[model samples]
Target: MSAKYNHWHKSRHSDPNGDCVEVAKGSGGTIGVRDSKAGTPDIVLELSRTEWAHLLTRLRNV
Candidate 1:
């Protein structure tokens, strides 16, 4: 079955002008990110399960 994902929340550090990145996730192992402003393409940066975990760990330390 295809798991569903949707934009949950906007970033707290988002631009005051409503120009920010929207993020979502799927059950499989992918993150969906896109620009909040109109007229922009959705940027889907796919990562392997292992890669995702490593990335998360690195980000937490940042």
Candidate 2:
């Protein structure tokens, strides 16, 4: 996820009702997560590359 990640990516599991989280890659190896249902001016949860990987692993195990 780089320049192509400039746009938010919602999961395939996202429902029509818009209940999902979106992920995007930011500069300096930072990752951004935000609510898909959050219209505009939403708060983004920022994570480092390592943190992002850990989160994915934890989620996958869940």
Candidate 1, 4-61: lDDT as tens digits: 5565457777998878766667677666555667565444555556776887799889
Q: Pick the candidate with the highest TM-score.
A: 2
lDDT of each: 0.64, 0.78
- Residue-wise lDDT of candidate 2 within 1-62, one digit each (tens)? 23234678888878888789888888667888888667753577888899999999999999
Q: What's model 2's overall lDDT?
A: 0.78
What's the residue-level lDDT of 46 in candidate 2? 81
User: On a 0 to 100 scale, what is the lDDT of residue 23 in model 1?
Assistant: 61
Structural similarity to truth (TM-score) of each candidate: 0.53, 0.77
